[model samples]
Target: MSKALSKAKGFKQSKSGTYLSMATTAYGVFGVAKQVKKARREHDTLRLLDAAVSAAAIVTGLALLVRELKRLGDDDVLLG
Candidate 1:
């Protein structure tokens, strides 16, 4: 019973977390692109680099989150 409960919670987290990450990454990239474009149009190299750095950080964080979810291995459908 406890083992079943653990799996259920983990599976739920993996599904919801991935979907949330997708949405967040989509919006974040869009925002970053807009920022970079604006900075480029204004010939602001510093802000352009800043935008790039922030976008890279966001990607890294998402990668870590997905890695953690994979390590958890809570998806029964996937395991099966």
Candidate 2:
């Protein structure tokens, strides 16, 4: 049925979105870490501050992704 197909597609989309969000968050964290390491090596206070802010953003993104994933899990359980 079309309704069943739609539900399946929606489920896939939700899972894919969660995975993508987690992947992006991980990449952001890795990028910030690299920047911080480079800044430390160069002894640049400004760069360090920038890196710190970026790191904080990445952490926030990760937390948001975790919350979203949890929500998706609950939704999946409810749907099933």
Candidate 3:
């Protein structure tokens, strides 16, 4: 049981898991873009600000995931 729990905890750092996270984060960016458009259409300053902040966070998360993926690729000893 402990081993299962450990694997589950570290699953996010795995290659496929990181790809899944990146995909979801990219989806979040699209959602944020929509929110920004809607907020601008209605002249909602607060909502626009919120969307901007969310977009920034999502971009940062994607950047981190990409870096992790690159690191994982570099660490693949089988390729060499």
**Pick by TM-score: which candidate is best?**
3
**Per-model CA lDDT versus the true structure:** 0.74, 0.76, 0.85
Model 3, C-alpha of 61: deviation from truth (Å): 0.4
Model 2, which residues run further than 4 Å from truth?
1-13, 77-80
Each prediction's TM-score against the native? Answer: 0.66, 0.69, 0.74
Error of 3 at 32 (Å): 0.7
lDDT tens digits, residues 2-67, model 3? 767777776776777788999999999788989999999999999999999999999899999999
Candidate 1: Cα lDDT at 43:
100
| Ten residues in sequence with the least summed lDDT for candidate 1 | 71-80
Q: Residue 55 CA error for candidate 1 (Å)? A: 1.2
Off by over 4 Å in 3: 1-10, 74-80
Highest lDDT against the true fold, candidate: 3
| RMSD in Å for all candidates | 4.4, 3.6, 3.8
Residue lDDT tens for model 1, 4-79: 7766665545656566665676678888999999999999999999999989988987787677667756653324
Q: 7-78 in candidate 2: lDDT tens per residue?
A: 766753475667776786788777778888999999999999999888888788878877777777656622
Model 1 TM-score on a 0 to 1 scale: 0.66
